[model samples]
Target chain A: MVVAEVSIVPIGEGPSVSKYVKKAIEVFKKYNLKVEPHAMGTVLEGDLEEILEAFKEAHREVLKDSKRVLSTLKIDERTDKENTIERKLRAIGIE
Target chain B: MVVAEVSIVPIGEGPSVSKYVKKAIEVFKKYNLKVEPHAMGTVLEGDLEEILEAFKEAHREVLKDSKRVLSTLKIDERTDKENTIERKLRAIGIE
Candidate 1:
């Protein structure tokens, strides 16, 4: 799963994040994306392609609002299972 | 009381907003500023001048973190008693 981090800056909302966040929740639900929220942002988890598409769609909405848009902190991540990159030698029958 | 809205962008933090926002809470406390969180942002309330000073202080910290800085949507507001701007015609002795 991929995690898409986002930061929205309202075009003219004057920093009323509560309104924008609530709308974001709706977008997530509409697109069936999984989100893990921490503070004023959300970590979206879904298929890579789908997640990116959703991100684009979300940003489009932000632009439409003309009251808000995504800011700098917005980012994306893909999960690769913890410690999977470091395999055990015994598991590989090596050493 | 005035409300100062703020947004942060971590310079090299790669968009890990959760971490930065948590730290921001500490900074807010350190400055003795009153914050009312509305989502991924905060609404600061205090004396008009004090509130603005606090905003400058907060932004300075963001820059110091070197991980993130303020973005658009940050705004400030000073409260005025409701209807005070438009005194009642009866009270003003004018129809």
Candidate 2:
């Protein structure tokens, strides 16, 4: 399994960007992945291919609304062990 | 200031990717940004423009050696307050 954290920033926009984030979250819901939204960004857990595809959609969804967007992603994939959002948090003692 | 977490994954490469990661880290060191290399990825603390530019360079650096690269970035930028890697960890009681 693969887990990724993504944050999309729309440049020149106002300080508040919850609306754009909401749009991306909406897109993520359409995919077969677990979504966790946090203060800094959103975490997605699923297969690597699916995760990357969902990320692409989410990026495009936000880009349609904002002219300039800077999206950040951090993907963690392990072939030896299963990795999930909850498992990662549990390891860090957050879950 | 902005703090971003970035991860670069080179596809089709063997499971071991430390070499590619090392190359990207070297590029990040050339900028005036604070670099914190963690288990999963690297955290960068600096201005938004500088961080983005540095990210672009780091991405290119990794891409040069790898045939296909998948990069992930999570940027946290605040206009009202200063944000650093240390402060972020301290907030979560990691420091």
Candidate 3:
């Protein structure tokens, strides 16, 4: 599983960006993806397969109107590394 | 410890916002705070004690120029909720 945080900036096409965002949400729904939509970007959660496909389609559609898009991506993999620490501590036989 | 994602928008006072951001960073540093600075806002990670103070100061500085400050905040507790499920499953005798 992976999370993709994507931001789409519009140049001469603010409305285009809005429309693209709405369309992207609809498409992600088709794939049963989790979406956290923001004013300027979206935070989506799903498996790599679903995320990659949906993101690609979303990117492509927005890029279709090149004169109106500036896309930025922020990716953060939310994982708890604490488990590794706990395992190591347990290996040392410490509670 | 808590992570606070704060967005500071400037009204007629964007430069004041920029200045406030810089000053705010300095103030946070004075108290040893972690900051993630973005174009539109900042993401600060610290204990509740540290974050609230810096944020309040930051908020005050920006609001000083009432004709030029708009502030927005977003908070997310980035904890792995999956762990609870994993532990429950383990107790139920599943991997």
lDDT score of residue A45 within candidate 3: 62
Instruction: Please identify which of the two predictions, 1 or 2, would achieve the higher TM-score against the true structure.
Output: 2
Best candidate, TM-score: 2
Candidate 1 DockQ vs. native:
0.04
**Per-residue lDDT for B1-95 in model 3, tens only?**
45455655556742223455566556566665566454334556556677777777776776775556555555433254322223322432335
What Cα-based lDDT does every candidate model obtain?
0.51, 0.76, 0.54
Shift of residue B2 alpha carbon in model 2, Å: 21
Candidate 1 ranges with C-alpha deviation above 4 Å: A1-24, A35-51, A58-73, A76-95, B1-23, B31-51, B61-73, B76-95
Rank list by TM-score: 2, 1, 3
True contacts kept of each: 0.00, 0.25, 0.00
Which tens-of-lDDT digit does each residue in B1-95 have in candidate 1? 44455555566765345455555555666665566443335555556666556656666766776754755344434234422111221222323
Q: What is the DockQ score of candidate 3, to 2 decimals?
A: 0.04
Candidate 3: tens digits of C-alpha lDDT, residues A6-90: 6555567632234556655666667756675543346666676777777777767767765666666544343543222233224
lDDT of 2 at B79: 45
Q: Model 3, residue B77: what's the lDDT?
A: 39
Tens-digit lDDT track for model 1 on A21-69? 6565567667756664433355565566776666666667767777547
- Tell me model 3's lDDT, rounded to 2 decimals: 0.54
Each candidate's DockQ score against the native complex?
0.04, 0.14, 0.04
